[model samples]
Target: MAQKSEIEWTDATWNPVTGCTKIGPGCDHCYAERFAERWRGIPGHPYEQGFDLRVWPERLDQPKRWKKPRMIFVNSMSDLFHKEIPRKFIDQVFETMESAHWHVFQVLTKRSSLMRNYIRKRYSDRSVPSNIWLGVSVEDKPHASRIEHLKQINSPARFISFEPLLGPVGEIDLKDIAWAIVGGESGPQARPMAEEWVVEIRNLCERDEVEFFFKQWGGPRPKSGGRLLDGVEWNGFPWQMVPEPILERLAS
Candidate 1:
């Protein structure tokens, strides 16, 4: 089942898979890990493994149960491309997405190389399902290159999530990219995010005409800072797959 998210970027969150390992600086003060540990003693809890990177095959069919159309954030508590998740399981996840055409699945991952390899080998012939939107997480300059890696895939819709914004990622090339989501880190021990950092990327998205969504002004307590930037909220979506023939119709 998906939770009604307070996250401004997306509507709901679905974790077909739960638990993930820290792979980067952004992983520090992980909300997922904290949530898992908090429920460690609870019986039948999905995050029993803490943050050790586990997959729940039983939860894979959750989306199909939802009859209404929705914008779903896939694996919010874990990474679908984690090394521990088997290739066959990845296929099963995709199988669910393929069957649930009414729901739009948004998948963001930190493992780009493995994603590229898996799609190229096992899932090559199959087109990235129209209802599925693929995205990569790039919290700093080093991970910025993952954007290029995402570009190589023939996904119907592609985007980037720059949340837990650790450092400035200046001037990203939004060539084939459809959307850009930016936000700062938030928690008790949250790191500081410079205003200039947010503005720079926002400006870049404007210049490129890419739909930019500003998530929050994260600080020691995100609730205190709130998500407002200059007295406004950015809630844009890059609908890249809507055929050119229908684009004009949508514009009117």
Candidate 2:
């Protein structure tokens, strides 16, 4: 089931899978890990094993029950393409997305290699659903290459979520990318984000005409810092797959 998100970047969150191991710097102060720990000892807890990845087969049909159209952030508490998750299960997730056409599924993964491989091998014949948006997390320069890897995969909409912004990611090449989301880390041990870094990405997105969403100015407590940056809030979405007619209607 989808839960309303405090994350300014997405509307709602759906976690058919939960728990994940930290793979990169972005995982330093993981909100999901902390949330999972809170559920420890509860029977049937999705993250009973703490941060050890686990899939919930019963949760697969959750999206179908929603009667309203929504923007869903898939696997908010876990990585869908983690090595522990089987290919068959990934197919089931996709099948559910395919059947539920009203909801737009946004899946972001740090496991770009697995995501690229799975899509190329299993979903080659089947077209990516127009309502499904795929993205990769690029926390720093080392991880920026994942953006290139993301380009290799065929998706109706492709984007980047550069949240927990560890360092300056100057001049991202949004050649084939549809959207770019930027934000600093937030939590009890959050890091400081330089204003110039956000400006650089914002300028780059403008230059390339890519949709830009600035999430927050993260500090030790994101709520204390608030989401405002430079006196205004950024809440943009890359509606690349949205039909022109619909966009026209929305504009009106």
* Cα lDDT for residue 17, candidate 1: 77
Runs of candidate 2 with Cα error greater than 4 angstroms are: 243-252
**What are the per-residue Cα lDDT tens digits for candidate 1 across 24-82?**
99898887787788777577776556666777777888888877566789999889999
TM match of model 1 to true structure: 0.91
Q: What is the lDDT of residue 199 in candidate 2?
A: 83
TM-score of model number 2: 0.92
Q: Encode model 2's per-residue lDDT on 1-252: one tens digit a residue.
A: 359887776668888888888889999889889878987877776656777788889999998998666678999999999898988899999999889887778999999988888888866887576778889998877888888889988875999998877888866688777888988887788888888878888888888877889887888766666667678887777776764543454455
Clashes of each: 0, 0
Q: Cα lDDT for residue 135, model 1?
A: 90
* Top of the candidates by lDDT: 2
Clashes of 1: 0
The whole-model lDDT of each prediction reads 0.80, 0.82
